[model samples]
Target: TRATDSPSPDVSPDPSPSEDGDNSEGAVPEGYLGSWSGSIDNASGHSTRELVIRQGEVGEAVLTLTAEGPLATGGTYRCVFEASLTAEPAEGEAVRIGPSTVTEGEPMASCTPGSPTTLTLLPDGSLSRENTSSGEKLTYTKSG
Candidate 1:
């Protein structure tokens, strides 16, 4: 199980699908702030990623990197993966993402975008993404 009680920062509940359809709990589930990481391996190579999705003022999920890499590209990546459910550097979990693409893939695509990745809490207290960017599935996991 994940180490600390963590929660995504910005999660809109009761959002109408057309307008919004999901019936999410108001704000992220309790204890949805902490660290999470994951990794990935494909034809290109392998990489590890870790993010500290912490609570912010007015209760918004913010990403504070605890672990990254050298020469990693710089730019806010579409943090479409959930903190608990999908961000575990698991082998098969879909790291579905969006417009935020490194294009170059590895080596240069290491520096994560210095922005708060919008993390939404799922009803199951897990996390998920929508219209996330399509990039190399760099499996990252929480270390701290």
Candidate 2:
């Protein structure tokens, strides 16, 4: 599956301002607006993934993920994942990413869409993601 720009079903809606009104429109935390890359080690094997976070119009964001590596079915593969940032995060809280859907997957790749994932911006300039249902945890470092 080649990477595609199509929107995913789990793409999050525009974020709404907090009741306290702390966040202004289009004011994405600087830390979350960049490219991140990491590797995944799961039951199937090892693979690499990249995530890019982009700010959209006021109070909106777009997130895209790309994973590539050997497939379980015995071939190389690649897939693109997408999700939207739904809610505004309070100061020092993890950015809430809506459920992720596979935008594209290589011919032999077995892609399974998962529940909403959270990207925690660490103090050390790193990020971590934990899938609530799959229990797959991936740690990423800022790349660009």
- Full-model lDDT for every candidate: 0.38, 0.77
**Residues 1-144 of candidate 2: C-alpha lDDT, one tens digit per residue:** 955887776566766466434554454577788899999776668899998988743334378889887776687788887887777777888777778788898862466666887778777888988786777778899999
Best model number under lDDT: 2
Model 1 Cα lDDT, one tens digit per residue, 19-124: 5214433233334455666554434444445555543322322344333333323433332322222232223333312223232333443434432233444455
Instruction: Output the TM-score of candidate 2.
Output: 0.73
What is the C-alpha local distance difference test score of candidate 2?
Answer: 0.77
List per-candidate RMSD values in Å: 16.6, 16.1
- Whole-structure CA lDDT of model 1: 0.38
Candidate whose TM-score is highest: 2
Candidate 2 colliding pairs:
1-105, 1-106, 26-58, 26-59
